[model samples]
Target: MPVAPAASLRSVRTLRGPGPLGAQVPGSGGAYWARLLPLLAALACVTRLPSFRWPLWSPDEGYLAVQARILAHGGELYETVVDRKPPLVPWLYEGSFALFGDSSLLPLKVLAVTAQLLTAVLLASLARRRWGDGAGRTAGVLYLLISIGLNPQDAQAATFEIFMLPCTAAAMWCADRRRWGAAGVAVACALLAKQTGGAVLLPVAWLLWRDGASRRCVARIAAGLCGPVLAAALLTTPSGFVFWTVTGSGAYASFTGSELHVLGRGLVNALVLAGACAGIVPPVVRVLRVARTGAPELWLWLASSAAAVLLGFHFFGHYYLQLMPPLALLGTAALQILPRERTARAIVATGCSCAVFLAWGFLAPRPDLAHAARLAEAVESRTGPKDKVLVWGIHPETYWLADRAPASRYLTAGLLTNYSGGRNGPQVGEKYAVGGTWPVFREELRRHPPTLVIDDSRGKPYGPDRVPSLRRILAEGYRPVLRVEGAVVYARVGRGGEGEGAVRGG
Candidate 1:
């Protein structure tokens, strides 16, 4: 029940259908909002609860949550813990931790669902304003269909993309109504949430200018953008933010055509699905005709979003979440073009819905996270409440799942090998991860050793080209007591007594 900002309120009077003596009704606006928003909110909650209840707990979720937990414990960003994403995501995680406690993944998933619901509401509002209530409701359904449908570990719950979606949709809703200032603020929120989100601004400004908005109005938008940008700069270390979001981000991305190939497959699949839904002709017409009409903003959104999506080689489905709003709108249009009154068209829509969902059934994996739970249980069984643990590899989620502190600042080797570049940084010590190699990890392990270490062979392994830090540590000081789910738990040899020798199912 957070209070709405002055610029953004769900004024229910605007939603009221034509009625006798509408203006004469007392307290009607509140009732309308109370009734309608609740239903939409309830629908959103119900639809997304399945994902929350059956969590996949991806590495992205784990890494982000661990960093936020570090920050929550009075640790500094980059220096205290490492990640390449902007400050806003960690801040959200910190907030979730602060309120819900850092032990379970429930808080983060709840926050993600809340964001998704807000995005759905904004989409519905925007669609309703543009077309009608039917269109608005359809837009909401489409968003949920895409978002909750991809409920696998692919995106998890609250990645940088999911958290930023509400803001992205809010910015769109505002811009669609010519509220440039509010739109700009919302856009800035999106950018702060994730660096990729900044790409949407170009199309936003272009839309404002092309729509003949006055220079003063556009200036207000610029001012709004500056407010958040300046505040974030003042709040975070300027050098750190720039290095992580820009330099580190660049180095992390592979400068190749690998992502483009995957993008083509996704495009083809989406086109085929769209064709099936409204037929090839109507969808094609909708794309062309809608671009020329007042909804030309969709084209700009698509262009900007495409540019953002092509940022690197590894492109996940969450990267495309930003397009859901505009695509939802477009889908609504495609649906509208069909005469639902006719049995043929009705049957076609129903068949398409079933077909699309069936395809998604193949695409999204069922929640089967016994491996993560087992790892967490094993690690928790070995470590004391205050004892720290190190998950050496890509599985930062282990830290969150075990509810343990990281042995050192670094979350995963990828953060070091990928985003990090400098050698003089505080986190770049002799051990843990020096020059993002095994030597640094070894040093970190010896210097501030964790009680229990979970070794993920799936991580960027040290071989002929790299040094074997974890293997060396395992040989020198650790004893494998338990192994399960492609992960090996190494208990510190001398740290534990005779009773702590081995875990069951080793």
Candidate 2:
């Protein structure tokens, strides 16, 4: 092992003390929790209250829940039930399902809440280390408040962005304290949670070079970064993991909207996000004002996060969640220099953001979970418990609602249609849907055809009418049984009834 030079040692000591980040704020004794508990409780209530009202929030949560159920029942990941994300999130969902039955989405909600709370705590700790107790509290509060400023789906759902935060925050926390190996492991853990988490390494790397870390320190960080990912690959289907996380990701990222649409949506997203996070404005301004004074690492962190947000080109509200923790930390550091009327500015900012989203929500239609519930009820009424169901379009919520297994590995029709999330229309991605998912879809249907096929793609670009194979399958072997809203239910002949009849509207 090599020794850190005297200058490096001094730098570490300085960071350990109150010079840069700040002396560790007093956290011992009863006084700490006494003051902090109310804030945490309020945060939990504000963030999760909406979650508890429903079993599921978004389609993303629905699919992930179904995937978790598949795993809980001894199904393999990527092979049995497929998704184009890294395995950790599904694994976490599996753990939640294992503990609490997969019958309800409460477990998943709980997991999301826990992740957010932990991230806030970690952010507070980070801020306190550099600033003071007040900054720590402010940072934690700002994170919790700003996190939930968006609509329930983006803010409350147990999505990838929500899970990635604590790991990334913790990584920086460790790096700031000069714990290289732990920091590396934390960064890798964040990546496992979400692909964008890989962006966290840039700031960490910059820290290493800036600190002039010893060769051994650098090696430890490298080992930490690679260790978990390699282990995950070894444990699961390595080929599947590589393909989904890397190759498939490329295809998904190939969405290139027209310049006009991109600019329009980008402006809207920016305004809404800025409004929602209005409270953070003072800290943001203060931090930028003193950007050269210290904490270049935080600026790097924010820059990298910004790059990650733009990587997809579709700037969804949740995408902006990645920017909050770094902002909170930097903002907290500038607490000493914050100008007057900070609270009033935050309140006004909050009002503006809320109004923007509220107006947007009213103007634009949101997916009604009630319709899904109705569809689920109809499917459940007609089908037996053992029968598997296949849902067309992106309505995986149907499968979760009906409490049925999916007939195919492709949970949604996106792969079949090459209709990924970012783009508005169902056009093929940069390359054709990774390795031709249609063949796999056909084979799966051939071997084990679904008892009930819910066609939720009536008006969609990838609707059955547009896809020849799907249309033929519907016409030949299946008959329409029921229609609920836009969704048309088809049942396999001989299984559904004596003879084909006109589909009856629900």
Candidate 3:
């Protein structure tokens, strides 16, 4: 790999102005705007183009959307609707739902696009502070390209990782500018966005200490980090916040496959990421070689992000989003030193790869919503708008599409069955649910009996027969009303069709 030359390194240092973060780079005037605006405009188009056609990008979106709807209607987080995720994302969705009405996902999609653009802009500014105007723009372009240069499910989704990136990038920029308190606030927001986002704090703290930040400065950052968290705790049930985000998160992370399985999955994820972002190879190599003194904090940031990506051993493509900002900065900076011809080739290659992803995102058949749509339709026809439904699997989409509330705080059966998407095979840890989730699930169902109990397990681990309480509930009051695409919809015997009860299907 062609590393950035020594001359380029010295040139960047000279361009760093006076202070680390507050340095005013040359050519950041009208000329910079002239070059940057077109690129940003292009970014806006590429980033949001796919989502315009398909509003609901992923199942996670459905989960958050439902949670936000619940929050909007006087429900509390964790107590009323639950997911083992931080509160910021649901709150963000609630704001969108409040503003645009939860019927359509256009508002949330727009927010996601704006976040991507803002994150790219922040990264560009950081690169400009570190390198120069050209490098900054290159970094921004690279970020926009690579972020969505994956399957639509991973890239276009308004996921936690997507929302987390801007805050993480903002923290990096603020820390570089010696704004400790602001950086800390950004860090807190990032952490609130996703657990992996806390990784950025390592690099930010390192930079502060390396720059000889005083005790008061450190105190300011600490306060910034704690204030939002305290506020969030007060807004929601603090105990629920700690349980879902921290305690439940611990168990969820630990529920992975064997060592061999994990290693295989990790290798595949790494290859997918590398192939998608192949243009950054030379830049990554350059950063590895020169980061010791030239950009130590960036190197640390990249390292920390990588560590975060490896968590849970399920390196889903979206997890790679955490790496893009830092990698974009380091890689674009490295490109500054390469020969003009080689640099053009790298950028062109990257553009070609990005174009492939964009084309697939737009041109490919819309995701297979047929089965889920059918299931939701079956549910909607039978249940009233105010009716509560329970799903016996990880199908949050059913709740969203049916436009019904959930009977239990456990939105998905994964919480009750210890079944993860890719981590485990057919085997579910029934014993794992012993740690209070099962009891809570049973109690929720008992208190607020669902009008419909839809078993979307499809012979998966958490089938109706697998859980004793679920089976008893079905036998005692619920009867199979309809079967849509392998999923059986069981309506309460006395609710939807009180007198038309039939024998439970085999």
Candidate 4:
């Protein structure tokens, strides 16, 4: 047989074989991917393990876990939980809890880790199909590293967003191969995962429409859009499924431009978004340039993915995590196109390292778990077993720590306090009252009494004009029984009817 042309050999090697020119020559394709994929998976697992033991559960995670527990106990989804988010995430957690028995964070953590690995694998497959196996492996390895580096707390198993990256990758791959049906299924899975996934369909349809005026392309996009609705109806119960259709308008309406102290928090959020985008820019630009010439399909995917993320949701950092893997692959593609020089490669490597370090150091700290735990214990010790504990202007960690049923209407003042300069704390019987004042609190106490009230005094100061509601309660019939490090527990005196119970700490 005649030898292959030099250009053909180079193209084959760059796309499928080993390195750019003279890197390690692969003996076979299967063996190379088999070895590389596992190593990448292991690296991904190691980075996320630190989060498993850390007492850093966000409000979303805490709420989802509670909802999952309720579902496990045969309660309906939205009716019993009444959160603004969709039900798929809670259902996933419930399934995990059923299998693992809920003793450790292993189940939830594993779910995220597994999803990340699967995402990496799908990305590699997509790249290999387009550029060749070698390029695909490089893309896969880069994606694995980026996913670990940008480990958003929302990437945890308890949220629907974790499914976004994998579903997006699968959809792109199917579309690239002209397998419309498979692409539709992937898009449908994405939609059921989160509304942002639905936004991605627009970019996908644009890409498909560009390829041809074929009726097949239109059919595919329609199928993808309908997939989520059909799946929801078939998989979820009627009573528990209402959350799928709920628009969460109240949740969005509550975000009033992050005014007051919230402005400080908003500024911090802005900086984080800027840094994340900057870190991924070199790679994103590279991928866009390459796709403009070589692979239009990949270009469409990147464009659609970015449009889905930026235009779809309010700028939450975790919402951008799904976009990172594709950005990493784009970076690898950029590397392939650049002049092969040590200095250029060194600059790229340094930029990536700095970005990863900043993200981990500045963005990933576990906030206020210890303080919340201490407050929870103090409240649990002072309150009766049957007494309901209401946390106003407090972290949800208090509920997790105290093992008490949360009040129907929690004051999210704590979230606002961090952003504002004002100091505030929740007062006794405030949730039972209408305006959370003395007269309203008094009437609420007479109507539906709580045996004990826990006041969190650890936060910012409420100016002279805004007196703590608990102060008035102390003047009336409630007396401070115990004051812990950052929290105070008040007991109902002569008027009390309920008995206190033993406190247990997990």
Q: Of the candidates shown, which would achieve the greatest TM-score relative to the real structure?
A: 3
For model 4, residues 384-418, the per-residue Cα lDDT tens digits are: 55666655444555665576655332233332222
Clashes of 3: 1
What TM-score, over all chains together, does every model reach? 0.77, 0.89, 0.92, 0.71
User: Taking the tens digit of each residue's C-alpha lDDT, what string does model 3 give over 1-506?
Assistant: 55447765663563333355546687646778777867876786676688777757777888898899889999999787887788999999999888889888888887888898889888888877666787777888888877776667788888899899999999988898888999999999999998889899998998899788799989989999989888887889999888887876554576344556667766776776676688988666754465434466777888999999888766677887788888777777677665557567777877887888788788867434556677788778877898898877776877888898889887877777667545465445566552577778778888888888888888776776777767887889777867776888887776635526653442
Please give the lDDT score for candidate 2: 0.75
Model 2 — which ten-residue stretch has the worst lDDT? Answer: 7-16
User: Which residues of candidate 4, in runs, are more than 4 Å off?
Assistant: 1-29, 150-158, 210-217, 230-246, 250-256, 259-280, 283-300, 303-314, 340-367, 383-388, 409-506
Ranking by lDDT: 3, 2, 1, 4
Q: lDDT: which is higher, 2 or 4?
A: 2
From the highest TM-score down, the ranking of the candidates is 3, 2, 1, 4
Least accurate stretch of 10 residues (summed lDDT) in model 4?
Answer: 419-428
Q: lDDT of all predictions, in order shown?
A: 0.63, 0.75, 0.78, 0.55
lDDT of 2 by residue, 1-506 (tens): 33346633433332233654344566673676568757876675555666666677688888888898888888888788788888888888888878887888787777788888889888877776665566667778767766766666777678788899999998988887788999999999999998899899988887788678789999999999999999988877999888878776664676554445555676776665676676776665644443333567877898999998888676676777898788766555554454446644654565456545444443443456888888899888877888898988786888888888899888887776666554555354323465757778788888998888889876767777778888888888898878999789998998636227778998
Cα miss at 381, model 3 (Å)?
Answer: 0.6
Name the lDDT value of residue 249 in candidate 1: 58
Overall local distance difference test of candidate 3: 0.78
